[model samples]
Target: MSAAYVEHRPISSSKDTLTDHHVVIVNGASVGGEFSTQLAAKNYACKEGYHPVHVARERHLQNRDIPDHWRKDPC
Candidate 1:
């Protein structure tokens, strides 16, 4: 697969915790993974009041600083 890119933007900030804010990813379709997995993570994070970010498969693979488990739950 080619390189993928992911972007994270926080729509709002919370006085309590980072997860208390709202976030969204504009280019979710280009992410190259199972839409369900991405959606599931997105829904799950939002439900928990956490920020949700999206990246292309390429970017995700290139990001060595991000932990493996974080890919599963990015909040």
Candidate 2:
């Protein structure tokens, strides 16, 4: 696959992450993966390249330590 470009507005702090209040969530999917879904499921917004499968996995990883509602649940 060709290189994929992800874009986002300037983030000022970790508070901007969709996964955690302490993490920095950047919008955009992996060139061949699912970083976007992982971020979006937690209410994170991205500009492009969103894969549901990938996002679901990211949500799972992000939720390993938090309560059910505290993290993104698998769809």
Candidate 3:
């Protein structure tokens, strides 16, 4: 061990199954993020959907006064 100690984390929802699958979701809403997070916790890959209209609505508060150039991807 050096000056800094390292730690290891066991992945959650370890699985022996190899039946790959995809989950199609609605726009990137809170529920969408939650679903993806849970599936990843269970060892599944995820694909999230995003619509410009939905994103604009969702990020209205965060982008209230910030200039477009300085903001990060609204997704």
Candidate 4:
């Protein structure tokens, strides 16, 4: 089974618009899974086991943030 893991870290000492970074982990690994929002990171990690399906659907919905390589087609 896979699970979502989140790590919080300050981006810098200065007061910035985006102060923190959220890294999403699953099965002790992270691959391009970083988000400005914790909810997005958690949602990314939660789809670990079903990445292809999620990517496909998200792509269909015109979610441009999703990487092209992660899509289900052309496999």
lDDT of 1 by residue, 1-75 (tens): 222223332222343323322223333342322333445546644454544443323221233256552353354
Badly placed stretches (over 4 Å) of model 1 are 1-36, 52-75
Candidate 3: tens digits of C-alpha lDDT, residues 1-75 = 101111112212344433232221232212322322223422211123222111111121222234441222223
Evaluate model 2: give its TM-score.
Answer: 0.16
lDDT of 4 by residue, 1-75 (tens): 543345444424344434356665445555555677655655665555423222222211222244552333211
RMSD of each: 11.0, 10.1, 17.2, 11.1
Global lDDT of each model?
0.36, 0.30, 0.23, 0.43
* Predicted structure with the largest lDDT when compared to the true one: 4
As a TM-score, model 1 comes out at 0.27
* Clash-forming residue pairs, model 3: none
Per-residue lDDT of candidate 2, residues 1-75 (tens digit): 112222222223354454322222333332333333334423332233222222223232332234342422232
- The whole-model C-alpha lDDT of candidate 2 against the native structure comes to 0.30
Clash counts for the predictions, in order: 10, 3, 0, 0
The true-versus-predicted C-alpha distance at residue 18 of model 4, in Å, is 8.7
Cα error of candidate 2 at position 66, Å? 21
Query: Which runs of model 3 end up more than 4 angstroms from their true locations?
Result: 1-12, 27-49, 52-75
- Using TM-score as the yardstick, the better of models 1 and 3 is 1
What's each prediction's TM-score?
A: 0.27, 0.16, 0.18, 0.42
